[model samples]
Target chain A: MASYLPTPDLSHLKSADYHNVYEPAEDSFLLLDALELEAPFLNDQLQPRWCLEVGAGSGIVSTFLAGQVLGSRAVDFGTCFVVTDLNPRALPVTQATWARNGLALHRLHCIQTDFIRGWRPAAQGFDVLVFNPPYVVTSPEEVGSQPRGRGGIDGRQVIDQFLPIVPTILSDRGVFYLVLIEQNRPQEIISIMRDQYGLLGSIVAQRKAGIEYLYIVKFSRDTSTT
Target chain B: MRLLTHNMLQCHVKSCNDPALNFPLQFQEVELEQIEAEENEALLLNLVGKIDWPALVQTTSELGITGLPPTKPDVVKNDPALMKRLHEILLETNVAQGKMVCRGCGHSYPIKDGIPNMLLAEHEI
Candidate 1:
């Protein structure tokens, strides 16, 4: 299923484009794998009203989900795509990537902000959310100064800040897909979502790519328990 | 940014917060473009139930749009005209460039080439 739909094209992006924005790699492709697996379920049943990717870098991941998972009949489903990224450079890079893929930009709205900070609900809350955060451990002081792919202090500096906001924004049937490394403590992270936020989480897919052992974890409100 | 999106955004600057009127951020010297899209009644119907009509009305007014009803109405499944108007205003009308100012604390966010930059100063957040 991974290669059935080709990984999106990045040939058009100039070398200068990769300076600040994250160049798509194993973590990004790992996320695409998870979304590919969920594509059938997302289209067949969820029919989400709003889908978002927070801290979207290069826009490839959200673009993949839009074309692959949300189905091309998005307008009829009334699904809106909101892509947020703090780096101003990444947003434009995202648009270029989407345009190259032959997807319409009219349906997707890109907002430059810190991880969904000022966004309120539109119609219903977001039903499908994805984040491939900056997960490389670095000093906490260096967190915001860097561009794309540097997570401070156990690689959870950025990821931890986002966890609490998930249960607040996700719809009743909502699901959030997040990518992490082994050092990010997947077990503890899942337990925290379940015990603290009341959102059930499990690792949906995992792979050892290069030197990084990547994991894609999904969280949703457990109807059986809640 | 589209008006539907502007409706969802407000002043996130912690000092000038919500549970207060910081939203429908007043538009100033804006540029708008109408990007045509197909009207989807099913999507509209699913979305209408959750829209905050007053906020949307305020946002449209900021853009000098006065066509929407003062208040949201009951489901008009058969009313194609109303559906088109809603679809047009909410999804089709795009804000290409502008400035959104907070009413609470007078903070401003800029919109350039169609995307709204909602970043605030460190002190604000």
Candidate 2:
């Protein structure tokens, strides 16, 4: 079995914080596993300068990315990790998470904004982007109503809204990692990204988490066509 | 918030997207604090390529904390004094309590407990 990156120390997070923020779950770990699997590529080839994590609830994913993926080589690669979330409670939780792991505050920045809204045209050229959006199938009203695990109808509302902007924000060598459930039609998402946006995508990792099947999809610009 | 974060942030208010006007939100009534952190010289040097030095200098000056040169200095690696100063400005200083006023829209985002509230109201969103 391949050794996985150690999970960030989230011991500081109490039960109270979970009430408002999205707790790290199976899906979150799956994303972390995928990032770890790609660590060699990320650190050696990509050498991402700016990394952004959308909807960084609990901030475990970004924290892991900073501490594990990039922290191992912090001196050589000065990657700035930026995370954004709509929840007011998540900002502080993320800060604490990073601090507990001994990561520098300057290396990680947290902003409370709705799906990259506050970081519009100015927040482009991201070398790496990761999002574990609300992928559970639910009513549209539940998308932004609460903190986490709620997605609108078919669970694609947030995913759909965020997909169009991926090509724009990503740098020429940028790569994006997104988490999805079986019900969300991962194939269709892959096709849409490849055909419409000219970005090629593939299922980098997948696991059966109880009744739900989780998939980690990675998308990058198709240099062949571009 | 650290000056490194401030370097990347810009006013995202609707109709304030212009690059020239949106950058480096002006600090207002800020309560700055310092917390000691492990110093990593290589990391600080790496950040120089991505940081907007001019904006950082101007913003820190506005906050009444002046140490960064008007221009980004060359030879950040060999100069220990310069590296120490950069380390403090980037990692040590934090906005414990205050708000950042957007240069373009004049909207204020509050900072409490060192976290900047970037959430905008429905109209702004």
Tens-digit lDDT string for candidate 1 (B24-111): 6888889989998766776667656656788888778766886788877775567778788888887788888988888888888899
lDDT of 2 by residue, B1-125 (tens): 77666676777777677677778888898898887867876667766766788888888888788777798777778788888988898888888888888878898988877777777776775
Q: Which ten contiguous residues of candidate 1 chain B have the minimum total lDDT?
A: B42-51
lDDT (0 to 1) per candidate: 0.82, 0.82
- Report the error of model 2 at residue A217, Å: 0.2
Against the true structure, what is model 2's DockQ? 0.52
Instruction: Give the winner by DockQ.
Output: 1
Model 1 pairs whose backbones collide: none
DockQ value for model 1: 0.69
Off by over 4 Å in 1: A121-124, B18-20
Q: What value does the lDDT take at residue B108 in candidate 2?
A: 90
Off by over 4 Å in 2: A1-3, A120-123, B73-79
Docking class of 2: medium
